[model samples]
Target: MSMGTQGAGAGLTRPAPATRAALLVLLVGAACLLLGPRLPWLVEWPAGWTVPATDWVGAALEWLLGGIKPVARGFSEMLRYPMDWADAALAVTPWPLVIGLVTALGWAIGGAPMAALGAVGLGFVLASGYWVQSMNTLALVAVSVPLALVLGMGIGILANEVPRLRGPVQVLLDVMQTVPTFAYLTPLLLLFGFGPVVGLIASAIYAAPPMARNVLLGLERVDSQIKEAAIMSGGSRLQQLFQVEIPSAGTQIMVGVNQCLMAALSMVIIAAVIGGFDDIGWEVLLTMRKAQFGQSLLAGLVIVAFAVIIDRMSAALASERNRQDQRVTAGLVLLAVAVTALFWRSLPDPAGFTLLAPVAEAVDRGLGAFTAANGATLDAIKNGAMFYGLLPLRIGLDDAVLEFTWGFQWTPAMSLALYALAAAGGLVLAFAGRATAGALLVIAVGILETGVANLAWPFVLTGAAALAWLAQGRKLALIVTLLLLTILLSGLFPRALLSLYLSGAAVFACALFGGAIGLVCAVSPLAWRMMRPICDMLQTIPLFVFLIPVLMFFQIGEFSAFLAICAYAIVPMIRYTRHGLVSTPTEMLEAATASGATAWQTMRDVRAPYAAPTILLGLNQTILYAFAMLVIAALIGTTGLGQSIYLALGQADVGLGISAGAAMAILALIADRLVQGFAEERRRALGL
Candidate 1:
């Protein structure tokens, strides 16, 4: 039987057994939650008498190396030696010759524009006196990215081969990706002892998951016919993977590589806090600490430059790889070897080049003057804004929400009614075709178990009103309704309120801003051109680097925190918007123009409607990004689930953290499901 038939048969046989299993699971979960506090015996803990071998080994190494300082010093020296050589080579080599070589290498691997962009970014770094640090950063990325790619690919292949392992592997990857960067630092520090190695290892771990997931997705998407053909030819698993699967999934795998590279670069900057290395990240940290605003900004620019170069190079490589006929592997190899040889031959002494010091000093002076001039004014503004503006706004909003929910008779009932309405809507939507009875039963159980049945009448009316208003192009009305509903629900249950409002606001704001920027960039060719590199930099530059600057400028508040959230969230919006707009059929555009439609009219009436599904997908991404940033934003201080999660990490409260994280995941799932439903409807309507 066909897979579809098998699936149908399984579905027919599944519901009763699955329902029973689910009930049992819920009972077990309830038991655990209720008795967990009193069941000391159920908790697992390491014996106090037991010694960890890794810790012992680390201690012995620490003793032999005379502690972390000497070990760090030795590692630094080892890495620095090559850097010194590169600096010497840079000094001796004529700028033109080096530029030419870099350009040539780029052209060989990618093309002329990529080579040109690479040269410009490199030259900019050199002139800005950040060449050495940039190179050091590059070296670490160079090592880590490939390692991540290889490891990710291996895992991805295994996941594809072993069908049973897929779900578990995906879950593990999700956890790895979501867990705070700081939480992993302690364990990594214990193992790698704080240096480039630790940073590289951490970056690799952070970067690999997406690649593995993407690779698996790509592999799974390959045509069954192609696989069958390969199998019929008596191809072994390894041979089929190499000859058919990899080749067919080449473009997707390359995309995974690009993601890996971007992820690694981002992590490398964050790793600086754990004493990764004396690269651009270290410089930015140092500059910030010393109140060297100009220096910090300049360091940020250099980092941005490095990010841009790597992003462009990888994108170009991916593109080149996509066009397999144009790729000249032999030529690239020759060019790389020649450049390396020439660079080595023209090496200079370390003492001769004091290029970076002058730049650093100048930055210090400029920053000092700026700070001195604006110190009091800036401080006063910052304090006033935080105290009078933000504090009052947040407090009033929270108070108003609380009062409205508690003081009003109808509001609480309305909120409960909305929940029931949503549940009913979900059941109707999900089961309208064939599984109506099962869906209704599931919804009934969910409502009853959750004690939402009491509020069902109010929730149904309120939710229906809200959703109806939304369907009629009344977004603001919908938003207001949602906010009110959230407030009332939160008042009823503060914990639930915290999770809903904070997560909802973050996602909404992120999608709004990201979508707006993306729309602008997508429409304007010049803006799109300018934004490409900036977007590339944003994508590749470490999240920590972005966080540092925002923290420095705005300090810790909802405003600063939101700004950081928006920065990361905006990427997909721009990317998807641009993609959607560009992918709109040229023939349609011409036809619209021929029909005497203005550009704005064409875009509004044709392009936008056509692109709605893709744009919605971007919004979905924005939600994910916003949710991800919520956890990260805790670093800058905010009291919510994120803060709780961070505190849990600090105290090694894994259970608490996991529970909170699950709550976050549920919020994410709700958004995902809602957006996915909308996207699916749009696609069907559009015949996509």
Candidate 2:
């Protein structure tokens, strides 16, 4: 019995598999660092070693596209008819009638609030002097949304009906969601040869996944008893699906509709980059390029107005509340008709209405004045962040710590001192039984000293594998290793690193600030009240519009892009963090109180641990958001795979665009998997 007890104790004292992996990773990193100076290949990938994967991808796609170009063009031509009809219908419709129709529809879908939203939102659009441009955009959305709905619904139904297809369908959707918006434009541009057709198709493709996902969710959530009842009622599978299951899932399907509308609208605007349509998005782009900041803001607002109206109206459909009276809707429509008919001859063209144009001009002048006045201050902030923060992360201390920038040149001796300090701290942590954290601290210091872009390939792989292994098990670690290896072989590894660096920097900034704000919001209801609307507005606005405000203050640069990414990505962090913290169970709080815990102590010891998985998921979302915005930021001024994708879009290089997109997607997938793994582990530990 004594010998058995000793064996059990010894077994319990052994380090976990994760700890062992971390130690192995640390050893690999240390070896790489020590030998790196003598081995150039350790610091950078050798050119001779990279496969010409991009060229091969290009060749394969060119051949494939050559075979399918005729069919694709035929389909494009087929799609053109509805797009043209929709465009002409909206174009010819009188502005008043259109506004009235939207208001009435809003009433039918929601109530007075939605009706008012429709009226005021459309009123702003009409007043912005971009009414004609807005019409062009609306027409594109009008046609593309239905196409997306049908395609997405069909996919969802098929996936639900066929179990084997579900996994593949889901995987495809994940890829679609992670791939940057601009990446879709390249191959489509090649297929369609530069037209609104490309935007139409791209918007449809981009917008479909949300609907498909929601449809699948809705169908799956239908009560099993309901399914049995339908079967007992002698309903055919088709009848059950279409008449019973679908109607039963109306709320979720409506939610899908809302997402589909928002996505289509956002994509249509982004597709303006292709420049075949005279939509509001194109107007914003045109004015922005001309340095007409005021006009750009106005056009962007028009897009925003449209987004809000569409979002609110569709969202209301998912609500259980009864819609407003039909008589009110009819009265509004009649009023619009009467007004249009009575003033038909004297009515001003909507395009000629420049009520907001003066405001726009003033805004432009004000922005100019503000920038001019604060030019020195802005420059200082920008330079300070770049020199102290982003530059170091990108290029490392050895390169970035220059006499002019950091006021001291980094020497080899300083590097040794940094490593020594890290080692000491790591040892202390290890002694405290936090071996993994200690090892991670040393690895982080090494990364900071070497810089992300200059990281040795083997070190990066080992670190990633360690994280994955700790997060889940061997399978995830191996998967991450293989995926990263593909990027390494693609010749796009350097650009991938740059992309990783920028997105990582933005995510770090977001997590730090966003977590603090969320904590404060959790502690104070008034703070949450103030923040809630701001979060809602930020989320409501499309990703493209985010660039405008950042660009207005900072102009075009990496700093501007970073700020844009943070602004867009920070919402989820704030929301999820607050939610996780505030959602601590009442019993747990009571238990802490009974144990004589103070409010702060309860929060620190009880709330935070329970919220760990939730917070990690929030961080996961922030990471993805950062990557999505990273590509859009490329339009202003950014380097990395985003730039490659954007350049490929312009050049119509299908190979480079797809390959770079895949690399970006791979990076995002890796981050997503690792975070999710950790969150899953936490959940399992809590038996949740």
Candidate 3:
């Protein structure tokens, strides 16, 4: 009579009482999903309700504040006096003074270019009429980033040291990373009363996960042999950590710092919504809300400039540290002092200037002009394109996809068929091995349960394209196929599939383009010299900031989003491809040359194939970068799983958001497994 008995009667025996309890839990969850939303009591709040304890606390705080009112007011006034002086000093400072300071600091740390870049970026922000707001933004970042870094490093170190805690910490970090930023606002608002402090706290929490994960990665990667050697030398724990682990892991930790800074920057705009002080985030948010496109765009640009300059400077410093360049160290110190002086001298007096008013006016005019000139055009284009172009194509493609899925008997039942085939194929390919049967089976059943069999054709086509490109070395065919599939998938399911395709296409295109560019740069000494700074900038620059200028030029759409994706995705491809080409065993290259092979022949037969697996791994990373960009792309009007996830955040639809996020994870997992499998096979073939 029980649920377990009913389940058993249906030939699916519940495992045990504990299992039955879990099943009951699942049933209750389902019931909640079905009924909770429509329940009146769930939606409504009791009227005129006040908690006595909360009132008592408020009264107590008020009474305490009243008693210390004079002291509190005096303290606030005292703080303001110095702030006033600093502001006055900053506002009257000559531009050259600031620039010189920045240049000097840069020269002391890493040298000329980095110092110059920092000075120039900061100057631009100030000159472009954002000095005060910029300072405010900088203040928040200065506070939050360090906190995030310390916490992340501490947690990471703890997790790494204790093996048992690693799994749970990782899981928590994963959930935190995937959870929408908006959800934190509600709880934070309740606790911190919607101020810059709350915003900083939220930003720190959001950013810390990546830093922690990266720290753990770096620590774990430290050579065990080196640690043992340190131990043998009678090194204390602190000594070992500082000398052995920390130094070795410095590069990754710096990378984590880069990630943390970028994440903090992302919160700037959002923080405005929750009473962020200093008007930088506020300006962007207000401009956007007020339809001040140009102003909003400009504010976003300022943020990007800051991000880029800091990125370049930090990267140079980190790299220079690795090389142990005293020049870099001295340059950084000088640069820092210069920056400090500039900031100190250029700080604005809050009392004298009406900063926000000018900003608001400029933004209003810009928005008005933009609306007058391009608003109608954009609307018309969007409407016509949606109706005449996108809608029709989407409809036809959707129909075709549906037909393909339903028409072939093998397709609707493809999950089962694929599993059976993969299992059989694995057995045959491995000489009757079943090493991965369980995994394959679980994947297949999961796909079936999720109803993704409806997308079988495109999936298979993509797989085929990957295989063909890998096996036959048909570059043009591969490119064409990839683009075609991307377009088709984009049309068929624009909401979910388009973003995926765009990401893939962007990665592929950027890889190809970057590879060519890298080769050209590498071939010419002068060009290589010219490109070194650029590459450094690219590596150090935050990925999120890449979206800002892109949005400026292209506006919100697929193009801007794709451009952002390409900018971030191309870096690894360029680096790896160049490394692979340069590192292709010297003996092999010599033998090929000795055998009278042409340069082209040597490259095609020797270098290309030799670098295939490494290049594939780069491609894998590019795909991941692309996928990661999807959520960011939503700011530019992408409607897909990304949009779904975004909406879920806005509405507090955790279940819906998580489910959609799962779909993305599944997509990543499938691509990862397939490419990795192919890579492994190729590596084995090459005896690598």
Candidate 4:
């Protein structure tokens, strides 16, 4: 062929943009690894170039908060009345009456099953002998939830009413979502001093975003025809909004309420770390510190009970199903009153109840015996996971591979061979028409060898740009690069990498394990039936409660933290995976069957690709959940940004707290955008 013909042929064979981006990322990573030893700067940022962003942030916030101290103190005082009222009322209420009231409310909303759940759940809480402590926690929730609801509703309505504010409001909500719950306590801690009011205000602030977001969503989704009808009926703007739009958006608002309740409860428990409350959260912390595992477990269970009851009851409000007879509710309430009157003098203090003490003791004894017998096995499991998985991922194989841990030292020659094999595999894959996959494989190999925390700044930035470009476009790529560069310059990049490593590890495990469980559940109704309630329970339980079981079995370490994160984060993966797989259109299955595809073949070729976007969404949720749990997991022994945030709380260093939180939020926000972009791309590709 002539020279012109050959050039045209080469042009036709050039890779697509995504493929080129992937290859660029791979090359940059490999070059960083090859040059890192000779150019030490490639592997680590210089201290001389670092900005004291933490100190600066602290100084600015201190100035701002100091200015508002008087107003905040007055506000705090005003808020205390409701808090105190709630506490006193709950503290003085008879335990039986509380249970009956909850059961009656449950019956009114959801009928027999909900009523039974409420009764049984409260019964368990009452029997656990933490009634007073539980009530204290509930009081905090009671006061904070109302505050959160009102604040969230106002924000949501304001955003909805003004078109100009919607974007900013959404951005605020998104940022708030990534900020860890504990991070909210630090500045509030300074403002409120050491008291339960800090927890109340912290929780109120932490829980408000969900409500605002949901309310805005609900309002936005209201049928336009309804608004038109209201207008045509000569209703004023406020009348239309209150009487029509808001009422029409009730379901979504109720969803917000449910989420608000959960957030308040979760934050309330976490806020006990500040040592100003005698709530059940405090009880759990106190017992855990004393090594009283049985009592801690009981307290944790009590929290779970409250969570389930609150979650279920609030959730019922959102459903369109017919409610149970109101007379039954009235009867139950009357019965409670009658019983209280009859037994007023003889009733024992709810605090003295210990009906479940023996049960807790048995659990403790059984746990002890099992651990004693399986101590070696448990140690082996933990050691194996650390040596083979986490350690290599943390500090890289070159450093982590040692005679004491991996049984053999990794040598330079072995590294050469590993690179050689990886290059060979990549070449083969490229030749097989999978250039993008091949490039990603090479990049993964480089990361595994170099470790996340040690990655060169240029390489990390390039990789993020490439991924963002592929996921969305130049705009997102620019945004991600800038945000990451800020973290890098701020000197928090190392800790951010550590956070990335742990959350990334947990997400990978969840994607694997939860995906498998989801697949199984998709294939079997019975499996889903069995797993559904467990998933619900896991989701309902507060993030703090997850530490109890893992701490019992594994003790306080990275492993315990890892397990807790996985347990909490895995639910979404499972739920989304099952829903995506099961919700595949019947027509697609029929077509596959007509084409003589086997069940496994249809699943792989038809179902898997169709479910990719949904599965990606699940992965996104899993990532966010893992990051959220990562902060709480710091209480045990996990390191990284989580530890920084927790430490900042202890020292009351608002600067470090806010800066570390911003860094963590940066990572989460980037991950969220990247995953969502990928999911959107998949949806467009599938024409969904």
Backbone clashes in each candidate structure, one number apiece?
A: 7, 0, 18, 0
lDDT digits (tens) for residues 1-688 of candidate 4: 1111123363556576777888888878777777888987777888888899999999999999999999999999998899899999998888778989998998998999999999999899888999888888888999999999999999999999999999999999999989987788899988878889999999999999999999999999999999999999999999999999999999999999999999999999999999557799999989887777888999999999899889988998987868578999999999998998899889899888989999889988998999999999999999899899998898888888999887899998887887788888988888787777777777887788778877888898998999899899999999999999889888999999999999999999999999999999999999999999999999999999899988888899998899999999999999999999998999999999999999999999999999999999999999999999999999999999999999999999999999999999999999999999999999999999
What is the C-alpha lDDT profile of model 2 across 1-688, one tens digit per residue? 1111122364455556666777788898888888888987886778898998989988998888888999999999999999999999998888999999998888888888888999999999999888899989998898899999999999999999999999999989989999999999988888887888899999999999999999999999999999999999998999999989999988999999999999999999999999657888888888877878888888889888998898888888887878468899899999999988998888899989989989998998999899999999999999999999999999999999999888889999999999999999988888887887787799889889989998889988988998898888889989999999999988888999999999999999999999999999999999999999899888889888988888888889999999999999999999999999999999999999999999999889999999999999999999999999999999889999999999999898899999999999999999999999999999998788
Specify the poorest-scoring 10-residue window by lDDT in model 1: 1-10
lDDT of 3: 0.60
Per-residue lDDT over 414-504 for candidate 3, one digit per residue giving the tens place of the 0 to 100 score: 5456556745654453333332333334333333332321233333344334443444435633553554344233232334454455565
- Please give each candidate's TM-score: 0.63, 0.97, 0.61, 0.98
- In model 4, pairs of residues that clash are none
Assess each prediction's global lDDT (C-alpha) against the native.
0.63, 0.91, 0.60, 0.91
Candidate 2 local Cα displacement, residue 607, angstroms: 1.3
- Across residues 1-688, which tens digit of lDDT does each residue of candidate 1 receive? 1111123353453334223333343344344334545853222121442234333443554455455655555665675555455545655555445555666666666666667776787767777666667667777777778779999999999999999999999877876765556555544554456466777778888899989988998999999999999999998999999999889988788888888888888778877766636688888877766666666777887787777766767666666443332344345445656765777656453334555667768766865576588878767776665444444233332222343333533244654575467557645643543243433454443333333212222333343334334333355335434534432332222333343444555566666766677778877889889988777666666665666666655666666776787787778888887788777889999999999999899989999988898988988888777777777777677656677666655554444444455545545544554566577778889898
List pairs with backbone clashes in candidate 2: none
Indicate the residue-level lDDT of 346 in model 1. 66
In TM-score terms, candidate 2 sits at 0.97
Prediction 3 TM-score vs. true: 0.61
